[model samples]
Target: MSDDPTGPPVSERTALRADCASCFGLCCVALTLTASADFAINKDAGTPCPNLAEDFRCGIHTRLRREGFSGCTVYDCFGAGQKVSQETYAGQDWRTSPDIARQMFRVFPVMRQLHELLWYLTEALTLPAAVSLHAELRASLDATERLTRLPAEDLAELDVSEHRDRVAALLLRAGELERAGVARRGKRSRRGADLIGARLTGADLRGAELRGAYLIAADLRGADLRRAELIGADFRDADLSDADLTGALFLTQAQLNAAKGNAATKLPDSLTRPSHWSADRLPTA
Candidate 1:
């Protein structure tokens, strides 16, 4: 995960998959929806989408983009969607067993978070600049992988968010260690920014304000985002492949997501893709 949000081609980096067939449409059934550009109608957690076929496939999947459902296009499964459908419940249909359905719904979100962490950890391991943090990254990767393999019942019972927060602390430390000598001196304010690792990949940003920012390892694959405000910043190892940006606002995407934001999440151009886990409603940046 480079500092540039839009550093490399998404194809070059490992993209998580959505194995829907293996997961019995758990994501569709477990998650709720509100009417917006992404979904045609509103839905609750347990009910299946009207377009869901009996075979467990989306009826309008092929036409989602044209049928006013582009939101579905950006969604990623991080493998949890399929894992729960097949491995966790052993291909058990949530529709057939109300209890299992409830459990599956409960665990889907948790697993999604776990998968997101896995994505970041794996990406971190690929960075040469982060060589000093390799040992820490590997440890975090192992821990995150173990969490991914937890049994349904245990996963349902575990405090996955707390665990994610704990792991995130280590990752943040790694970033600090990697950029130790590069720290800027000054105070800035970047409240509620939505960076999510924008593909700055090599832009020139000197002395910007980035408080409560959302910069999740955006392709910054190697841009310079230094000497910025960075109060509650977020930076989840964006791409930063080889850009040049210096002295930007905020710090990381994780910091931004954990902080408060209104309808003003200033995002990087490259990370315009909507989150699959997020509802169609825009974030109150």
Candidate 2:
């Protein structure tokens, strides 16, 4: 799995999904969390979380949301965790190599961003509406994949924000082309709208541009979100139990993680339902 141009195939693209079993608990270790509405305690970067197990698994994985670490449920390393643990580090454990702990921690966040670009590029290529841009998309995808395979020294020096900016531009163009119905959102664009705790159940948000919108705790049960551009929208604690999100573009796992959803919710093929979320769980009235 060293530098390969072809990258992971479409089927294997899903395999790029985070395999926490093969990971070194990077999210729980490399990342930090302070006592806030999200985490219950303060954790400095590079320190292993108290809930981290000997096998690199979260000891309280299932109880994370209940234990006041609801933020943990929203974080996704986008398969970077496994790639770093198994490929980049070549099976070395931090316990044995305390010297490389800093490098490993730094590389994890960088790799996660790179992997997220891979996810977007992979998804962009899947959209048939952007058929004309496929060649350019493929080129960017291959280049991003190659970057992810770079050595730790190179990765630490990478201009991750620059790469993300370039990739974001491309994804934006693709989203525009795919969602020809973009004009349907409304005359008043809700871009970055602050609708926290608003009563929006069953609202017609089709094709709405809600990028960076703060939707924390918004009650959106059964909302029609078809063709909506949900890039960077916060769904934290918002009720999405019966929402239809088919064709919603640019939404991330992190955003979805912050939301509450159930079996009736419709999501894109690229995402899987949070394990902590269940069908029988009723929305708070």
Candidate 2 per-residue lDDT over residues 20-122, each given as its tens digit: 9888898999888999999999999989999999988999987987899888888888899999989989998787888888899999999988888887788
List TM-scores for all candidates, in order: 0.62, 0.90
Off by over 4 Å in 1: 1-15, 96-98, 176-191, 194-285
Model 1 root mean square deviation, Cα atoms: 9.7
Question: 173-235 in candidate 1: lDDT tens per residue?
Answer: 544443444545542334476766455544444345544567665654334455344434554
Candidate number achieving the greatest lDDT relative to the actual structure? 2
For all predictions, the C-alpha RMSD in Å is: 9.7, 3.5
Best by TM-score: 2
